[model samples]
Target: MASTGDTVQNLPVEEAVARGGVTEIEKGARDSTDELRHYQSSDFASLRDEIHKEITSRDVLLRKLEESVTRLSEDIAPVKDYVMAEMEEEDDDASSSSSDTPEDGAPQDGDQETEEERNIRALNRCVDVMMSLTEIRENNEEKTKKVRGFYEKIYKASPLTSLMLKFLERNGGVKVIIDCDSKDISNLVRGLANLDGEKCAGTTLHKFADFFECKVYLGGEAGKYQVWEGLKWVDKYHDPEASLSQSLAQMVMYLIFKNRGFPYKCDDDQCEKLYEKIAQEALQKMTSGAYMDYLINDALSMKTPLGREVSLISVVPGMLVKHGSQGGMRTLQEQVPFLTYFFMQHVIPKMRSIIN
Candidate 1:
């Protein structure tokens, strides 16, 4: 009985030890499972935080891109406007260029008529006078006496007629006067005559005598004979070297007017026409070298034909003293002022009738 009790106790002890070992193994497994579960939960939380941060950063970048697009659209608007404006300006320039015409393409409205037109008009007006003169000359061709008598009568009636006759006697007769005064009657007579005799009637000797008379007239009324004596004295003594040009000019004027009689009277139309014809003839005669030289040298050179030297210069600033010192120089200078005064006092007032 003691041996059975001992075996029974040993069996109870073995059963207790097996139970304690099983309990320890189960506790260790439970602890490992809990540790694994905790680690997994922490890893999951960290991953979630990283993903949220990435998503928020993406949202911020999208907002900035939208703002940049809006700014770019605003900047492009002005550029588009500038381009449109430049295109419009180019179109306007093109249109203006197309409408323009070159200067050489056409005549201007304000251009003047040509010289040929004026010449044609003047020629037409001259035809009638020319025809009448031709008829008179043809009719009187064979009757030298009758023609001479007719001319004499015409000469006595009009100063211009007498002048024309005188000019016709020269080689290149009665052409120069026409050239100088085709439009003026009085100038024709004035240009051809000497002071004392009619230019048309005087011979070369008479012309010289007439020049002496003119010198006397200008010299303040020395007797005619005395004047002749004085010219003879000049010929003998003072400037025997004097040119004949001045003497010739004076003779031309005198001869031109002497035969016609002073203050040539004419009220009739025939007389007027005769005067015009005579004037034209005189002009035609005087244009030659002999007549032109005589007029220019003799008439133009006569300063104080009476033999008194007249000084014409004025004392003014900037004038050279040397110019005033010479007698002829001074006289020439005075002519300008005298002419200016005369034109202002006489010519300008008479110009009303002549102005267009």
Candidate 2:
């Protein structure tokens, strides 16, 4: 019986020990699971916040870009329209203007012109005038004035000034100048100096005059030579790369001696004095704003000649100058034609021998 009591007590103790071990293991597992879940939740929240912030920033950037593009397109719209209109062919205008068949008896697309084509035509007109320089000089006074008035339009409205240098170069050399402005005998003298890049094949006389004759003409005591000396640079007047515009400006300077006419082959001491006087006058006029003022005031009005309804702003935009507000560089460019006519009509007679 004593042995049976001992067995019962030992059995109870063993059962209790097993129960406690199982409970402790289950509690440890539960704590571990809860800690893992808490850590995972915190990490996921941080990742989600970062993703949301990135998406919001991208959205704001996209909106700002859209607004900037809208403003830019609006700003360029007028310029775009103007360019398209200018580039459009004249077929539409011609078809609308005359319902009657063209003189050729049928509509010809090739006959229509764009703004560029019209400019080319005007450039051709300049070529025609240049070819007829001698005949024009012999023309009667009234006819000459009419011709002058007509050509004045070509210089003012057309891109002839910008295109003149290149065009003259391609379609033969100094001949273009001779044909275009016969009255401007001044150009005859000055034009010879610029034939270095011209197509003057086998023209020994022109090359000789270009190198030797015009050198003396431009190298007078107070002329281009002295101007070069003042600038402290070697004179490149005869350099092949010399600019046509500089040659033109030099012609303007020589115009002061128009009363006496340019001495192409002459060597009188009086000619030397005249060169100095003209140089001083040019410097003073350019520095004192007189040259600019004259150009502004005397520049031709393009409003009436281009068309009945054309405005000055349409022809030349961004006119900041006060007097010639209608046309800026466009107006200044007209000086080429105006000076050409003046030199031809007024100074040619005095230097007829030089031209001949």
Candidate 3:
């Protein structure tokens, strides 16, 4: 009962084929979309669950370390009490011996121990036992500190941390956002233009301006990061003439400290003060010409007692000079390795002190 026009064979060959192809293409697209949705829903959910479980495990481990430290503290309390008691008893005995004139006729009690003497002996034995336990408690406290520190390092290095950082950055939750200045952007564009030998530099600044949201302003060059000190926001700005190496070092140290629980912005007043102090110290050291002079004059030439050499200058690419300013002063690229090494060696210890 169907008309010949409804049948594919009766239609123009191209038209019939075109309609069939379009239907196939549409069906394929729908299938692909369905697969993508399923993959996202299932796989992403599973991944999130895995990350949650890992975070929970790390937290449990940290909690255990805290509990161990608490138990040690509790155990050490009795030792502290016993030590105090012994000190008081010794003082009392010293006073009694010094004040009491032995009655010449009194029976000498040296052969047999008096109740007080026996008590003192017992106290001494208890003190000995407590001292041993105190030692153990101290060792455990140290180990707990070490374990907690290791856990932090592991957590910071984990993929979850990477994911969290990415999420924060994308959501504009980052405490510090460094915007490239006009001069920097222009320089970058010119450099790129030189590489490409193109006229792309003309529109580069305009394109960058249009790309960012209207609320954002980009300018200035500083080797330091912005931090939060309690309710106050502290901007640690460095010299504008600072090298790229200095900026790289600053960023690296910031990330390292951030991972070590020294977040740039925080609500805790103590943390804010500590980080602010650290930030100021870091800025001073990084920008100090005196430090550079010291590194070149003293630190670089130092050798081990056995005559084996140990120096960061040796690791740099070019031949280093010990005498002239040309040899002493390094290029921007040359400064990267030594500056990074210097920050890691000097600043990291300060950061580590707060880890516990």
Off by over 4 Å in 3: 1-22, 61-76, 85-356
- Each model's backbone clash number: 34, 6, 0
Judging by lDDT, tell me the better candidate of 1 and 3: 3
lDDT by residue (tens digit), candidate 3, 202-241: 2232111111111111122434445455499765433221
- Report the lDDT tens digits of candidate 2 across residue range 21-123: 4445556787988999988998889998999898887567445534543343243344334323432432345544554436666656654543445545444
By the TM-score metric, which is better: model 1 or model 3? 3
- The window of 10 residues in a row where model 2 has the poorest summed lDDT is 306-315
Model 2 residue 278 CA deviation in Å: 8.5
Cα displacement (angstroms), candidate 1, residue 268, comes to 28
RMSD of each: 47.9, 26.2, 25.8
Candidate order by decreasing TM-score? 3, 2, 1
After superposition, the stretches of candidate 1 with alpha carbons farther than 4 Å from their true spots are 1-111, 114-116, 123-194, 197-201, 205-297, 300-337, 340-345, 348-356
Task: Tell how far residue 277 is off in model 2, in angstroms.
Answer: 9.5
